[model samples]
Target chain A: MKKLAILFMMVGILIVFPGVLQGQASLKELTLSERTIQDPMKSWTITFTQPINKGTLKKQNFLIKDDKKRQVKAKLSLSKDEKKVTITPESPYKKGVTYYLYIKGNVKSGSNAFLNEHTVLPFKIGAVPKESKNSSGKTTTNDKQPASSSGKTASSGSDSKSSSNASTSTSSKTPGKNLVKVQTKKHSHFDEISVQVSDYVTKVKAGSNEFEYKGNNLFVLYQPGLKSGEKITVKGYSMSGKVLETKEVVIP
Target chain B: MKKLKGIGVAFILLLSILMPALNQSVSAAAAPRIDHTSPAANEQNVPIDTDIRIYFNSDIRGISSQYIKLFEKSNGTYYDFPIKTVKKDGEALHILPEKSLGFNKEYMVQFNGPAVDLLNGTYNQHLSYTFQTNYIDFYELMVVNEGRLMNMLDTYAPRQIKAFAPKRYINEISVIHKKTGSLKGDQASFNGITNIDINTKSEDVVNVHVDIMKDGKSLQKGYASKVTGTKASKNQFTFDIGFSNIPDFYDVRVTVLNNAQQTIDSKIIKFAAEDGKAITSFKESYKYKTAGNGYTFHELLSKESLFADLLAESMMQDIKVQVEDR
Candidate 1:
């Protein structure tokens, strides 16, 4: 009986020790650039020190979860050099919410070497405030209403205070300037808003209704009952919930 | 008041967090110069309420109304226009007018001296630009390739210009030739031909003129054609334009002209190279070729083994002949 127990113990040790060794190897964390993001429309660009295997860029390897631990739907795109991966949320992240970007140990490098680290990067959106205040002291909240003619009241949140926020945020932006081109085309019964926005823009708002970025240089929004010669204001926001640009376009 | 204070604190905190990123991107050390302008020089059909913007190559201190002036031309005289705001945002200057500009009127902007630059002392270059406000709005102005070929060139190929106006205000279509991209060999000797088809739906006749522009100056002379005006929609008129090669990239500007000879709609169409061919097919055009001369050590050894086998076979035959003679 003692000899049999010794044999079982030896077998158990051989089975469990490799797993412990692997768990220790994968505990390594990668340093991130920005920990707190203000823009709800922000996309995270995570660059790896070594080239990644394209086949390993699967949902099991890359994931983003909100504070509720629910997986947030995001798009993973590998850079041409295979050393950078961009994580873009399908929808805007909720304000004042914390999200964790997880890179699993299953992810492999180009040389077939495992990352060996269950990397978790925690980032917060919109700082500590759940609601932002405008100049009139009215707390601004994200309006979840569908775009329509009756949605005018929802746009009041983007008043002078938000414009001031846009100006301040844009002043601190580095590198160069961002040009937002807005063109309003008057149709028979509706006005089509066509804007040329850069990749950095997370949301494009016309009047009060928000338009999805759609991962393109240009996006369009339709407003009903809009007349020719009428003017409309367009705004673009970054991932940090900060307004990057505001432009007034006339319907033509 | 408390909300404002909270916002101020948040703004300061955000600025503090973004300061490191801001410092890393700004590496300019040169004097600020005019990179470009919104209503470019001689640009036509500008929106009446369009904000006049001046983008700079580097950062500027601020925008000054004293250095920037706007004027409206009426009755052969220029009148000073009121500027409501002059703001320096980032690396650009934003100018807003008190009210919307007059329609179908010419406006001139003058940029005088003493704009403070971030690095250098001041940028005092005197520059002036002029633009004409649009009269009518065009719903769509498209340049379509009618030939169905990917890269069409010369007079045999017919391209179409479709203009959809809200009203019947379009009078004519103007084709302005502009050179782009690098040339193959000699810029002065290279040439090509292209045909344009104007498709309009106006009650008035629309004329077509191909004007050649050199070094930003209009030559004012080229091919011209007159087409019958039809009250019906989708009328087509085709004309040919012959041109010489200047640069590598080729683009032509098609404009819709009003009764006052002012451009109401304009579109720039870039010609694509067919089957990965060079943009300009000049006499001295060159093609790219890729060659591989790399071999692995195993391949080199295999090649050497074949030579060694041949030498050994020859030596064996000589030994066999010597043995037979013995």
Candidate 2:
């Protein structure tokens, strides 16, 4: 195990900073002509690295949410070659509001390779005023704030804190911008479990206790001493030492 | 909670000790025995050519084959025959005799002595069985110079050529006999086929052509030759056609023509060139398949020899299967 612990640490580091290993271009991308929450929501185009199967492109894979995490309905369609997909919102974008568009990594390419990474795109419907940033061009709090001066759309600070607390419970459930989804698989000969890091985690729990990091996944020698059907739970830690997420895996 | 834990530990400990003792007693008491056998013991009319299967209650040690013997009882004597085993699992054996048994013959097999089982226990018992075969009587062209046929092929050929030249292909005989000195040809060991393609319009009028081909080229051919029998002139239907000189080895195509010179039928007869092993597959196909042509010859076989032949084949096949599986 000392080597195994080093392996887990490497996996945790890789999960936290994936773009450092693979180029950003390797991931599927979504293109937006305009990001401002102005009005009259139009369509957004999503392109995959490889041609995808049309049947696997489900609307559920595209989750459009508001700041409160409330889902917005949308229609998704794939092109004939299935390389490109278009997602159209049923309702127009509300001005001064930010929407979060989350696409899952489970979408399959025609040849069966999955998109394998979830992407989150956060954009507003309206543009910021020209003078929102300081002359030094550093993005200060002012630039980060919603551009809309309209008070009706600005969320209350209390509600934001409450939503943040609610989100902490199942932090790494989805493939977030910073979190890599831990998908564990077992075979007759080997058992592998990926120790995923959520957005907040800078390290993963994958050392000692018979756990060793092998690249992106942690492998237990065959299996844990857990009885049949027992599950092993692991926790991901944030840079500040807070628990970001807890994951459980079982082996036969 | 603590009391329940203690009880659980005690229960597991009890099982660990009792289970092994119980298993040992049961295993020691049981003996390896045959659960069932193909052609069933004392079976009659068994196919002249087939494999034998023996299923045992317990696995037999592979070395136990030395304790088994399969032979034919001809004239109250035993003759060793060719056998090939296919599958020999610890609990099962498949025997395939390399040749077909003569029709209406008796075959015998005995499993003697320390037949060991998986548990290292010896089954010190003797088991024997006899079975009869019923098939279209098939006859072989025998070259009997008081049993040893003269070798005409090469140095490997039987050393007694002059010993059997006078009665070459004259006397028809069974595929096997208890006589130890018989130097039968490899082809003679096979039960002559009730081949569908070998009919003659009239034994004397038909023109039979025997062509010996090597690598698809006819090395030799014989036509309008005289091949006489023991008492009567050899008919076209049952004569062994010979090349001018016995060359190296086997497949010969026999083509028959009607008196008008019209081609009637033909067949390729394959024989093993060495070891006295018969071409079992050829005989088996003939035995199992329906003869498409209207032709047959009557002959008799010893049931005892045929049974032993079948048992030997199955046992041999079983061993082969075991080797392959291993």
Candidate 3:
């Protein structure tokens, strides 16, 4: 009877030892929050619950895939402390795009154990504003304002007024008052019609059909010909486009 | 008792016999023997003009003719110099330099492994040695920074110096100043100058001067200065000034004559200054934003901006590009 008892005890010890040793070898646990797609042009930091082992991380190991399992622009970088892995897209993540994050092969836990095989974290990107297209086939009006060319109609005039109001609301939120204000001025000289785009009125070349625009102190030029006193809409694209400004110009 | 005694005796004999063999094996693995070298190892400071020669005892196989490398210490960075090898006297390996080494600088020659002995199939260990070149007589002066200038000897002048300034700043560099009586037109001059400006709208300008002299006589001089151009929309400018006709035997000196000088500020830079090169110029468009996660596009932009600013300030004869993390 004593021998049987001893045999049972030995079996239990053998089974439990491996488990204890494995537990000790475990380095740390890592938890990833739901993935998010913010600004693509800007870098986004993905926070992790715990630091991960960076030694096992390689460029090709982590991947981002669309719903069809097709690969998209993706890059993985490990933090200095080996705590977090920051994934970045080569381009901005398109709004309203869904993607899956897959952690594979080279990814390892802090204890140097391989991460779960085929580990995948899926998430959807937010909706982005679609580019507006002109269905009328006459002239396409951009997100800036009503078609600057079709300013003769009352409907167009009312559209310009609403856009101008929107531009004012956007400009008030701008950080600095000295910020260059962009205005679109339309001109027409018979067959040659040109629009002048300038950040400030001072930088505009009067009657020359050439105008310059400024943002972040950078200057850009636009040349379009239109008649004098013609109602034209000017719109501004800020770094964030949050401070878009549109103004009416009378070409002299 | 008898069996136990026999076992003990056998164990002792085994240990004694294996001990010497183990010791020999460990020593052989730990320290490799130096067979022979071309110019020979532990050779005293040799001439900088001479090609490096090293010969090993074993016939080396699978050794790449281009495996040898030369490194120079610069600003805490190891800059690699290309080395060429020639087969001489049948078995000896000779490394020749495409260009003479800088004087008074410590250089290291390294042989990458895969240098194998043809006879025994044993690999030759990686080999390296450090040595200094003989000093040249004249000093070379260059502008490394707006406020900081490098004073160097002709034998030890750096291949290049990096500078930073606004896009619109005018850069003027003169190896030997024609305006100063110290340097004659016929005499060799190492004096140079560079000027540059990047902020044309702001009208920001950076002017600097570099000079080398000995006993009140200028050996090398350089000057650079720039002003805003006709295009108010364009704000950046770069220049490269070369120091030619450097005379032998002179001390080096460098000074920031003017951080920003214009015609209105004619007396901005001091008349006399000190020390030092090849002129190379580069330019790149600037972008402001972060490109991706764990990566800041700002750094790339800064590097591009710095390179463009430097290239505009110097005359670079040649440039080599190496891509990493691609």
For lDDT, the strongest prediction is 1
- Interface RMSD, Å, model 1: 28.3
TM-score of chain B of each: 0.34, 0.38, 0.33
In candidate 3 chain B, where is summed lDDT lowest over 10 consecutive residues? B317-326
Model 3 CA deviation exceeding 4 Å by range = A1-252, B1-35, B38-44, B58-62, B65-67, B75-77, B84-89, B116-122, B134-326
| Cα-based RMSD of candidate 1 | 39.7
**lDDT tens string, model 1, A10-38?**
88987878675565354545322124455
lDDT of 3 at B112: 81
For B153-215, candidate 2 gives per-residue lDDT tens digits of 222222211110000111121111111111232211111221112323343246667665543
- What are the per-model DockQ values? 0.00, 0.00, 0.00
Fnat values, candidates in order: 0.00, 0.00, 0.00
Best by TM-score, which number?
2
- For candidate 3, lDDT tens digit of each residue in A1-252? 999999999888879786755531352221111233334443333322234557656655566777776787767776776644656778655655666565553344455444322334444453232232222223322233210110000011223221100000010110111123334332121111232321211122223222222122322333322455665443333222222333444544
Q: Supply candidate 3's per-residue lDDT for A15.
A: 90
> Which portions of model 1 miss their true places by more than 4 Å?
A1-252, B1-29, B137-326
2 versus 3: better TM-score goes to: 2
